[model samples]
Target: MFKRVTVLLGLNADAVADHAKASATVVKILRTLTTTVQGLAELRNQLGLGHGRAAPSPALTRHARLALNSTVTVTEFVIDTWQDRIDRGKLPPCSQ
Candidate 1:
């Protein structure tokens, strides 16, 4: 998902693993966003929300909440950046 977002922004890399070869700004954002997404993924797994584990996973309410917030922040940043590009005509408008 993060890769898709970056690609839409015109970054060449397709995954976080390729961050090492990306430009400085791309690498920086990818590193930070990658950490946030990883934390969110871990929380989802531990909470048994997406993982195919049995019910009654260990509860970490506070930590999970924080992770969810972080996830939203990161997601919004990518979305807003994309929208800004469109508004500024840096990116083409969506076709009907």
Candidate 2:
């Protein structure tokens, strides 16, 4: 989600305020998702099976983690790449 948002922000590189707001929203959503992940993990632990709880099938977990890591990497890449423009008042002024 954050990476998607970051990509969108980069596409709007000529617009500053909108990009700032979009970045803030993405950060908020990421925080919320992190919290949700923790809660889900707690719930999974609480519902342990009588015979050792089965792990998520490796195939499913593998791609899910990879996707998540990829997203974070992309988000950081966007942030690092454009942060100078954002800070130096280089982005174009918002329209309308």
Candidate 3:
């Protein structure tokens, strides 16, 4: 999911990788962000609501808050990147 979104937003590392103009920091940050989200997805699959649990969830309020905050940060970053691409005309106008 992260890769797909990254590609759609023109944030794919391949676009910038192997290019002298690329920012190493940006690529590293994106990779880290994707890994963090992937970790969150695994946490959700294991302890989050929806999957049948024989007992109570092990998650605490702090855990939920962390996940929520991480989600918001990731979402905002992706949206900002996408808008930046559109603004620079690297991407075409979004059609609803």
Candidate 4:
């Protein structure tokens, strides 16, 4: 007999830990994308600010650069791992 459960319970027929890991991976990618875009926007805003009015603080520039770099690295690592797993037949194609 089939049973129904609320999504709130987060039940899955597939390996629960694998499902969770996959979800976390996707979330991390999305978060990194959002952060990278936001960082770039902030950097642009700092550039647009006139030099006469206080210069873009070095700290802000440094922080933005660091965030952008981290996001890029994280995204690349996730993508590579996902692709490698799929290529090696370790993971099935994800479907919605």
Per-prediction TM-score, please? 0.65, 0.34, 0.77, 0.39
Show the lowest summed lDDT stretch of 10 residues, model 2. Answer: 7-16
Residues 3-89 of candidate 3 have per-residue lDDT tens digits of 788878867544454674566667787888899899999999899866776777799999999999999999999888888888988
Report the C-alpha displacement of residue 40, candidate 3, in angstroms. Answer: 1.0
Q: Clashes in model 3: which pairs?
A: none
Model 4 Cα shift for residue 63 (angstroms) = 0.5
Model 3 alpha-carbon drift over 4 Å, by segment: 12-22, 52-55
Tens digits of per-residue lDDT, candidate 2, 1-96, equal: 544544544533443365777777766655555555455455445643324757643345665565566557655755664675567675554468
Report model 4's TM-score to 2 decimal places. 0.39
Output the worst ten-in-a-row residue range by lDDT, candidate 1: 11-20
Q: Pick the candidate with the highest TM-score.
A: 3
> lDDT per residue, candidate 1, 52-75, as tens digits?
676665767877678778978887
How much lDDT does candidate 4 score? 0.54
Q: What's the true lDDT of residue 40 in model 4? A: 62
Clashes of each: 0, 0, 0, 0
Order of candidates by TM-score, top first? 3, 1, 4, 2
**Cα lDDT of model 4 by residue, 20-78, tens digit:** 88867766655555556566666656754545657655556677677668657755755
Provide C-alpha RMSD values for all models, in order. 5.9, 11.4, 3.4, 11.2
Candidate 2 lDDT score at position 81: 47
In candidate 1, list every pair of residues with a backbone clash.
none
